[model samples]
Target: MSYTPVYFSLREFVDPAIFAARGNNCWQLLSPEILRAADWLRGIFGPITVNNSYNGGRYSESGLRRWESTVGAKYSQHKFGRALDLKFRAPVTPQQVYAHILANQADARAHGITTVEDINSTPTWLHIDCRNWADQDVPVMVKVVQP
Candidate 1:
C-alpha cells in the first residue's frame, strides 16, 4: 500500500506559501508526531476544521508571529507546526471537548499528544500540540483561564 495522508490536507495544515515552496512545503515539514496527534484528535472528536476566514487555526512562521503579537505567546507550538488551534461547532462546547480529551489523557502517548490547552476564555478554541516531548513525563491536558 502507498503512504496515504489523512486527518488533514496540505492546505488544511498550513498557509498557501507553504504549498508554493513545493520542495519545502509545510506538509513536508510537519513532524509525524504532530500529524499523528491531529489524527488522534479526529479519532476522539469526530472531525476538526482548521483555518477559515473566521479564525485561522494553523500557521507558518510569519503567521505564528502575527498570532503571537495578537495573543502574546512568542514560543507557541504553532510556530513549529507542532500545534493546531481548532474551531468547535454545533453539539460541542469547549468544556465538553476538553473534558473528553482529559478523559483519555492516558492514551495520548499513543497518539503523540503531549499537550492540550483549552484557551476557551477568549475567542474559544482548543490548542493541542506535541512539541518538545522530552519535557513531559506524561500528557498535560489543562484549561487556561485567561485573566
Candidate 2:
C-alpha cells in the first residue's frame, strides 16, 4: 500500500551522492508522506524538476540533502527526506503553485503537505515539506514559512 511517485524517479528525489551510494534503496530513506505530496503536486501541476543531475542538469540538492551539505539550514527537512524544492516547467510558475496550495489547503493537507517556503523567498522554486505543524498549534492548513 505504499505510494510511490508516478511522475518522478529515485534520482529526482535524491542527490547524486545518495543516488550513487544507495541506488534504488534510496527510496527506503524517504518519507512516504513527502512522496505522496510530491505526486499529488505533480498531478495537479505539470512537470516538476527536483534533482536533475542524472540528466546533466544543474539541480542536485533540490531534493534530498546530505548532512554535510551546507545548502539550507543545518536542520533542514531536506536532510531528513521530508522536503523538496520543485522547479516547474514553463507555463507553470512557483507563484501559481503556491497560490494553488494556499487556496486548496485541505486538499494539500490530504496529500501530506504541511508547510511551504514563502514564494518571495524561493522565486524560482516551490519548497514543500511534511513537517509536523500540528504540534505548533498553527491554525493554518498549510503553513507558509519565511525560509
Query: Residue 120's C-alpha lDDT in candidate 2?
Result: 97
For candidate 2, write residues 1-147 as lDDT tens digits.
367888889999898998889899999889898999989988988789999988999999988898899999999999999999999988999999999999998888889899999999999999999988646455448988988
Candidate 1 lDDT over residue span 1-147, tens digit each: 112247666566664544555534555456677677667667666766765432453433322223334443666666666666765666776567767777776666567666666445534667667666544654454323232
The Cα error of candidate 1 at residue 86, in Å, is 1.1
Q: Could you tell me every candidate's TM-score relative to the true structure?
A: 0.70, 0.94
Each model's lDDT comes to 0.58, 0.90
In TM-score terms, candidate 2 sits at 0.94
Deviation from native of the Cα of residue 71 in model 1, angstroms: 5.6
